[model samples]
Target chain A: MRIKGYVFTLFFVLGVIQDSVDGRPLLLSLSRPHPDSAADFARWLVSQNSWGVLNTIASDLGGAPFGNVVSYSDGLPNKGSGIPYFYLTTLDPTASNALKDQRSSFTISEYPIGTCGKTDPENPTCAKITLTGKLKLLDGNSDEVEYARTALFSKHPEMKDWPKGHNFQIFKLEIEDIFMINWFGGPKPLTVKEYLHIEMNKVAFVV
Target chain B: MRIKGYVFTLFFVLGVIQDSVDGRPLLLSLSRPHPDSAADFARWLVSQNSWGVLNTIASDLGGAPFGNVVSYSDGLPNKGSGIPYFYLTTLDPTASNALKDQRSSFTISEYPIGTCGKTDPENPTCAKITLTGKLKLLDGNSDEVEYARTALFSKHPEMKDWPKGHNFQIFKLEIEDIFMINWFGGPKPLTVKEYLHIEMNKVAFVV
Candidate 1:
């Protein structure tokens, strides 16, 4: 009785802390799709995650693959576009690299999503997805840029207050291939067409 | 004092949950190094994080960069070598890609380490690092392999119980260049030699 009250209070406090720390509220409402539902699972992974390693070719380093930590959004909450958009500046190597080569990949892990309970991050049961494609910078005047900005700012409110002198612009990964491993059988057979078209009805509302 | 008792009990329960989910004890002891201490900060980020995205060139996908979620360790707790070691299998594309081309990079984020407080993961204050180097697979008979396996299994206990036929091997990133942004000034200028040679005496105990 009293113990239950304490537990609830604790969780509430922890929830608030997590929300503030992560810059968005905890994803409590959306249920994880079964591993067999590859398209849904892939889309859910992208939409649920706030940040991932965005890989680009570093021409200065003899064209080695360079992965940079960056925040991204597919859309606003449940309204995901299945395409990741970023707010980047030329001051960073990731944006600079993309301008020269454009070949890139973005990787997200289910580990940080707080769902892979007691599972080793490398364990095949833990979900991970990589969207491989050309990283294209969006035009300043495009309607897509407007939609992407809303998506980015809603998730990361501090982004709106960033330094104007940095010349932050929108860049998105034009996914050409998908690589995901959620179960023991190996990489799931998923295509870009399938991933982009899957209806996210099962994801529920974002809390 | 009743409120204090409830808060304590709640935190105790949550700590257990976080430890199990992360597959290691919560890092509540060690203090974060100042961002100006680039070498210490970089080493601390690598040592504390258990998982990251390792990027490689996907030969099958026209040599586009491929990033995969992976588990890694620098050394046994508090005895870090400042070099990232990974347990990889050829079944995964990261290991397969590394074999074809050793040019790769491993990225780690301080966000997962839970010390960034309310900072956004992409914010400069929330440090991130990319170690551009060759991902070399160690020989089976090498003494270094023995050290690496100890480093890996200590942090991730379930690796020992993994399926025997999977044939997981040890791999290390021979870091040549370091790109880290821990504060407002942009990427810190750090070299591989300085990063490896820095004394980790300030990190304190593992608990």
Candidate 2:
């Protein structure tokens, strides 16, 4: 019995260690809010994910909706403000497109956060959020830029080292609408005000 | 010496086993194509990923670009046709939006595939591709729907069991343009013709 117990503990520890090495969040990190808590669930999905698709109206493509995979931060770790900030370079079409037309959306999925285990990403229950509004570039000297830079660099450290010649600048989604699906029966009705005002204490991270 | 050798072998086996369990691809599975091979690299990105952000012109949202997390498959396993197929329900805005306007883009990233390896997902070297074109709903009785169903089901097994009342239907992206970035440079100039013709023999999966 002692030997069996020892073997079980060893395997458990190994599993946790391997999960960390693979960059997957353990169950403790995935403290999902109940689906009924629409605003909280939307905040949870955005805060947990590090990257998402940033869509823009591409003028070059005859006003087609162009989506690009990009990294973004809502805030630092557990202190997300429900507003997504992005570090974009004009060299990329997304930024350039946004310059031409500020209307855009940022979409993130819970699948990559490891909370929607075994569920297809497209599955209604898997949880996906789209923040729709104007994508505006912030003035470099603004205090919001400082906060956004900190939020972005903390999550994506490599951003600090990106070439200055590329002219990377801070851009944020001025969220006017929120479309989130954490369960069936269509997207939950979540207003931008409701999403932005959700207190952090209401939906605490388990880890 | 014999004890040390045994310990090393045990840990190595455990690591591999844990990686498999975690669903992170073993290093052997990540055979990246040279960044210079635009068509090959683009094809590999689409083939390896089972999900992406499918963007569409949202007529309801003042014609703003809307992106949604979606599961898609090009074909079964290693036999992708370079055209992505999706099983989406009109209950979702993405499918309904596509019906109103065909202009859309499907974007996928290398980050989720576990090959980016410590690189920020937004890092240019990490690779991201957006296939820009029309998102068309295929006829239920079309032969292409059969192929798409097989491809989508093989990748996302849970999709097969989704509620029938939701009315999931087949949709395919008629890729008119290919935008991919695999290295520290601007978008690779990959025409749709070049991307569609890249034979499987040229870029074989390592695993």
Candidate 3:
């Protein structure tokens, strides 16, 4: 019970930070980068559990987004937990259909990084992030898939139960482009690096 | 010479296969996302010095589109090869200025996913992917910055040379929104299960 409270507290503080940052007027950082901050988010990711949704956008097919739950095996021998990758096997047909169409992009969003519940029903944990990239069906035999799966299983052993069948094939998500909304609220967009790594995990203070 | 030519030819053929599966028509393979016709491309990626380029969009302070080069670190602890992570660093004041001015977005074309030519234009390999996402200064201790760096660097040893400075903070191209262009060319996309415990060192026939 106490652990739950602590988790709740962490989320609350996180909200405050996001709101404060988003509330401020927008400013560019790189125009030179602050390597320190980038590293911050990455480390945080290394420290926690990675659960998120894998999404793809085939606007040509439909305007609605395609989403799925994914569990990551983050502890690959060489990759950082901060840069965790996942192996997904969904029975949903949306993914398979997308591949057949040979579309141009897919959007992946992280379920709100922190205490993912409703503070604002309309935008609750909509700290949703979308990554745009060219989707490629990896050759079932290549080492990439093996690496991807190994990376995923290292973190999540439960994934071994993944469904398999006649039409079953595995595809990988190669990130191409990215966008992130404020962890706070409004249009305080963020960079993908900020949310994915350690920042999301360590995001203890909000507003 | 023959080896390099073999590598280059292999690269183009892979590109075509990548285009067919990702850029062409959409195929649905959720639950079991087995992307079709993406095999050749994956093999090609492995064969080509283990790094490739992803042409993507970066949103500038003004909300305009710009191109940015994405350096892929396919080789993990052995960074010279293996499924590398794409990277980009911002040390230019102009980039910081632009980010400070506008919260931007970047679109990435995942083709040759490796280090781009230097932004300065003098270096032959100096490719610059566009920049997006507003940049911010690290807090005094900059817990965030530290976190991100370790996550990425621990995996990509070459990351040690990544741009770093006192006031300068380095960050990565975290993708948010993405799409792909596909047309079946060589190998197909990998299946979900094979992703675990896999090795990615295969080369498909080149065009």
Candidate 4:
């Protein structure tokens, strides 16, 4: 009986490890909101993804649109405030390009979250959102900078240990226009006001 | 003896499945070349990833750079040909935006390939590449279109079934500049010629 108990426990631990590898935690598996709930769905997509492509006008490349992979956060987990915050260093072209031309956009995909299942990343049902706005650097001394840091560090624990000599600083996209495609039919008509004002209650989360 | 054999076979099957999930096929786990081999490294990155952010100038949004999630292919599996090909539809902003302004870039991250392991997506060590140049629509009748279709369908099988009314077409990035950061210092100094011409022998693959 003692030997059998030991074997059972070993299999149980192995099963848990496999589940984590193939499945997201229960909290993350919450069913996606209906596509008609554009505002809520868009915000949920932003809150769940950890990274995206940050685009900027590259003056060096003769004004070509440049996209770079970056990590960002809106708030702590489910408490997203609908604003995407970033940590950038001027050593990269994205920051320099933004300084030269503030016009930019940040895009995230629901495909990475594993909720898209077997759908192609380009499938409208998989969902993709682009937040078009100016990329602005936050004042180092501002209170928002403190909050942004906490939010970023909480999601990406490794950021705090990134090289200080690189001079990484806080940046945020002041979203003016929202473009999202979550389902069939053309882009959904979602106003910036509707997207920003979506109440947290509308976004259901499985306990 | 029969019961013990049945238990052994069950464990063997479970182990095989777990290994398949954790280890990419022997072909993909081929070790990454030294970052110094610029062209080989760039081609490897493009061939290994199935999707990326395709950026285009959104003229309607005050010329802000808009990045959208897209699936792409360089060629058929191990025969990648150094150029990234995409299937796009004008119904989507990325395609329409490209038609209005050819200036664009395609960005891909190594993080999705599962090779980044514990490294943060934004960590310089976790490779990222952006190919900046023109987003040109290919002539539907061209021979390259046939090649592009085969390359794309082989990787993203579901794409072949995407809505036909959407008028999906082939587009390719005419890469003029390569910005890749696979290691700490900064973007590697790689000219388009060097990035396009490196011989395949330089990139080693594990058997």
Candidate 5:
């Protein structure tokens, strides 16, 4: 128990320190850049005004992919790539049914509306970048619970009136995967390889 | 094989017809909307912007949810109810690696930039949405490959010479499960039930 307590304390400290990095994933499955590069990516995200799509694996029903959309709040840690945080409220029977059947994955994609010919509104091309993570529904306020909520709302003020109940569940996603799309071409398609090495270079993600 | 095709085609036809009403699952998951709700939802998606997050579950893979930001050019067979229908290119090693390890769940969420608050240059709240589906990679069209080159420029224009080889590797997501975010409040969070009800009442999606 003592060792556990010590470990808990260490984790707590690490979580707080992690705040310094914002909500960016502490451990990404890919390459990590220098602190400067990390900072560059974070600043770019805010400046770009990019929205995030998060992907997670739901619990299950036979074998199929279940997914949901939730908005991401990038301001929590404030450093940019800090922690990828967001808030979502659902009352749909379909979502509830899916949730009941299995956990869901969220894909948060950010894009530059103007740059990708999305400026006209009549015909828009959106450039996208995605983050991959795992989400767990939270019970009540505990250590991680509070952190998640605080981090979420700090960035998205619109979520201020959402209720707190078993109905208004909170999901926590452990960051895992990250990808960005090079969508400069309007309808013309690009390969996954070109996507990574070419168009995506502008986004300065944690590559 | 012919008989099996016939049966599958029958199911396909029935599903296409019942899209909006029943939310039928099909090979191209984001193929279309339920007949009844097709027009309304299509209008909504256009008004709300077709660019949103799609949350999906790889029911086969422990209900893993995946979210991808996709470009939607509906007017296809069944393109309403906001079912995703498009192409995506991902070269991220992590994403490819993840696919090798497991199937994925995906989701896409959409939010109006200024719906909740004011969106200005300094204070920007980006509009969002997603396409959640099973993922796989593919190459770009031979004729249009050059323009699709990301090596030219991260932005829309080109910088220098184009890269060689198959421009795109490929990442195609056949969607099965999905949900869109209905965020109109602050921190309190809206329940999916309420959101879905609003969507249903506002429009008729059932075939």
Candidate 6:
């Protein structure tokens, strides 16, 4: 009986300490970064989320903003680059749209990360980010493509086995503007340079 | 010892039967709808999800496609209207942008619903839907407003208590096009009429 009790206690402690859902590696914890820390919060949002809606200008739809659900990664676990990379094929409208007009935005929510708790997904405190920029296709031969593939495949392991005939190419968003709402007030002012250059290791997230 | 074993088995079976994570109500089971049942699948997707990325054309950002994370409800619990209604404020760019250009698209994924299992979010089988149409703000006095408010507040109770100073108004997507991908093939052939008119009760969901 004592041994069983010890095992259950250990499991409970581990669950509380880690507290990460969906098997995602923990960099950000149950409690998020301070909303005032705009750059840190923005970077943490991008780093922690593996997928978001990638929006693009659909020429066929009379220039309406077309949003598609997509999987993306900033970098390998814990070592996020703050630049979201995608594995896309021209067969999809988003990639085709990007080819015609690179203007795009990727939106991620804290709700799916399961840290939003009881707060509504739309609640400002739940944390949502939109990275607006050019969705550029990387040259297949470039060194960055290798990094991107490693980053994407590491997070979404099944991507490595995705059908090759679809001719998936690597794409990265060159973030020019950041719109993030993490608290009661409107968007926190964050510059692209500040978002990209923040030393992620120095951010000191409470785990 | 016999009673303890029975209790453990009961817990294990209950976990498998109702495998819903994140405290979301289980309407669609772990095994999702057939991709061939396009209307059923689409309605299931919308009814099962509480929030999604609402895309709008940002006139200020040189007509870039801007996607924002927002909470939305189609109707109440199992009684879904299929027309996604949102509680938005003009202070937000999405609402303001819609006032300028009603053209918009809302994207939702099966991933957040927790039914996709290990399938990569971007995987065709994981299921995603984008409803493109005009985002029209409902007349505050209309009977639909009552339905919309009830729908929105029931799914997202926090929305009712949001700051009245923000002037949150009810808006809904007048869906014109349905773009859904649920399997290996590209988007399923679904029309606005088919999606909205589908008798959700007739199409059986295995729960």
Winning model by DockQ: 6
Give one digit per residue, the lDDT tens place, for model 4 in B93-128.
889988888999999988766667667789998899
Task: Compose the digit string of candidate 2's lDDT tens values, residues A24-111.
Answer: 4533443566687787678877876789999999899989999998999988876788899999999999999999899999999887
How does candidate 4 fare on TM-score?
0.85
Q: Model 6 - which docking category?
A: medium
lDDT of each: 0.84, 0.82, 0.33, 0.81, 0.36, 0.84
| lDDT by residue for model 1 (A98-168), tens | 99999999999988877687688899899999999999999999999999999999988999999999999
List the RMSD of every prediction in angstroms: 8.9, 9.2, 21.5, 11.2, 16.2, 9.0
Provide per-model DockQ scores: 0.46, 0.48, 0.01, 0.41, 0.19, 0.52
Ranking by TM-score: 1, 6, 2, 4, 5, 3
Q: After superposing candidate 4 on the true structure, give the runs of residues whose Cα lies further than 4 Å from its correct spot.
A: A1-31, A201-207, B1-29, B199-207
After superposition, which runs of candidate 6 have C-alpha atoms over 4 Å from their true positions? A1-17, A23-31, A202-207, B1-19, B23-31, B201-207
Which candidate, 2 or 4, would have the higher TM-score against the true structure? 2
Ranking of candidates on lDDT, top first: 6, 1, 2, 4, 5, 3
Rate residue B76 of model 5 by lDDT: 28
| Chain A TM per prediction | 0.86, 0.86, 0.50, 0.85, 0.47, 0.86
Instruction: Tell me the docking grade of candidate 1.
Output: acceptable
Residue A64 lDDT, candidate 6, scale 0-100: 85
Backbone steric clashes in candidate 3, count = 172
lDDT score, candidate 1, position B69? 96
- Cα lDDT, model 2, residue A62: 87
Residue A39 alpha-carbon offset, candidate 4, angstroms:
1.1
Q: How high a TM-score does candidate 5 get?
A: 0.45
Clashing pairs in 1: none
How much does each candidate deviate at the interface, measured as C-alpha RMSD after superposition?
2.2, 2.1, 19.7, 3.0, 11.1, 1.5
